[model samples]
Target: MKNCDFAYYLSNFFTTYLPGHLNVSENTVYSYRDTFTRLLTYFKDERSVPPDKLKFSHFSRDSVEDFLKWLENTSHCGISTRNQRLAAIKSFFRYVQVEQPEYLMLCQSIISIRSKKSPKPTIQYLTGEEMKLLLEQPDTADRNGRRDLALLSLLYDSAARVQEICDLTVRNLRLTSPPVVRLNGKGRKIREVPLSAPCADILRKYMQERKLDRQDRMDEPLFFNSQGRNLTRSGVSFILAKYISKANAVSPHSLPSTITPHCIRYSKAMHLLESGVNLIYIRDFLGHESIETTQIYAKANPEKKRAAISKTCDDSSAPKMPDWNDNPDLMSFLKGL
Candidate 1:
């Protein structure tokens, strides 16, 4: 099949069957798109399809298996990543099978390519001290201090994923009786989370300062740079990194490997778990499709890990051991032998 045609079919299948039947979200559709791009590049290199003659049948069971191997050995991709790619490939093959029953045999075998289950990477979050420095790091003496405080507060207040927080518009934020934020999560699924008293007051002050009339047709982003435009994701990351960097100077929380938007994600979940919030509520907060995914942070944390080891293990508590080599009974037996 032509590359363009194949691409069109893939999109159609994702839109029609994926969302309609499988109940996947828009973010999922986006992931499949990325997976296919990687798959094609691999196939092009292997088959030398420089011109326009790579057919769908080029994807045999063995070729698919080889791609799986490449995911680990060559790309060094993680388990979650490899599973997503495998899912995309399976979707494509399933579509082809429906179109051409002759490919049924091939598709059936591809279904057996199971994803290996592994514990998710441990999520890193701020220690209590770290969060203290971060919140306090925003210069309250400056004009942007309140705004910075509000932005950081809102991110943790709702336990929102970074993408969901970045995509917010002015209309999405509500500081009324419910004190809610309308978050557009993965697959464009919208959920409302409550804002704290401090967040509401800070945002109120910032909006009043900007003279942002609700009636005005402002097409710009909700959070603005100094020039007044929506804050880019990278810009937000840089902003957080700035504070994290300063905090790390005082404590180890700001180490390069330890800080990220996702770390903030972990921070919020950890806060909720410690606060005795229900896991289901946190699942809704994080916009995760399942509670199983959210439960990772609810499990034992780093401090808990250390505490567990200390509580359960102690060298002084161990049973005394005999030195059989130096014992007189063993020495006498050896001499007789």
Candidate 2:
């Protein structure tokens, strides 16, 4: 009815506060918008609170908790997804508290609700042999095959997110003495990742063939589909899946069934770590804000851990202690205790 209403504030929150004040990306804004859409849907279906009649007071701590539970139980969302929705709601309420201080207690209650703990996901990556098999799957003689080879090579070499690869323009490439590709990462952060000689060679040829090396075409996407548009995430995944299937057909265990573009990134990171690359450099390469995030690669690496353990001592020369159960004095002492 008035500008002070929940609908009014919600509208302004998306249109003004997120974009104007916070300067969040379009993707982020869309994600937040989706969360609110789901929230409204939950209210309508579960609580019988219609969209227009929904108020800020409807988002009480108990109601928010119930919605999260509904997401898991009824909606079949994972813990991470549930946490993400909660985070989005919390962010909105935080903005509301600043604008409408009268609802401070309610806002604080929702904010105080801790995120549910989710188990750390195992980082799936390709091994060197598996990577070799995958890279060889594409028929390099054909144009599309050459493109796929170049795409896979760059995907692994740059250790980029799928979105970063999608965002790549012709100008982002610099095939100089030390070739590098500029990756636009999350939070508007940019990082330059050095490409391997093979990767650079493939990219150089792909660009030359597509006329992307021309100054006029600098704004063009580095990789495109049959439609001459930049490859979407699903497009890239589809390409990978096709090759993965082929690779697996040849050697049944060459690649994992669940391999995605992200696995290529993880594979690259693992390869670098296995090669003794410093975590700091890996962090910068992967565009991670914290070294802790990069450390997951190191932690997940069992080979590195095994190598370290192997170097600690020679088992053959180590002194052996008597078995406690076989020693009469030790057994008597244990019985007394």
Local accuracy of candidate 2 as per-residue lDDT tens digits, 1-337? 3523799889999999998998888778888988889989999999999999888767789999999999999989999999989989999999989998998999999999999898999999999989999999999889999999999999998999999999999999999879999998888888999988989999999889988899999998998988999999999999999999998788867678899999999999999999999999999999999999999999999998999889987989888655666766976757655
RMSD of candidate 2 to the true fold? Answer: 3.0
Single out the weakest 10-residue window by summed lDDT for candidate 2: 319-328
CA lDDT for candidate 2: 0.91
- Residue lDDT tens for model 1, 1-337: 4555555666678777788877777678778878877777777776566324456556677888888778888889988888889988888788867876876897888977888897857677876666767887788677777677777888777877777767777788777776888888876678888888877877777776766536473444567788877777787788888877776677654555457877877888898877778989888888889889887885646655676689988798977566556667986656555
The reply for model 1, stretches above 4 Å from the true place, is: 1-8, 14-26, 143-146, 217-220, 226-229, 250-257, 302-337
Could you tell me how far off, in angstroms, the CA of residue 291 lies in candidate 1 after the best superposition? 2.5
lDDT of 1 at 149: 73
Q: How much RMSD separates candidate 1 from the native structure?
A: 5.8
Best by TM-score: 2
After superposition, the stretches of candidate 2 with alpha carbons farther than 4 Å from their true spots are 1-4, 313-337
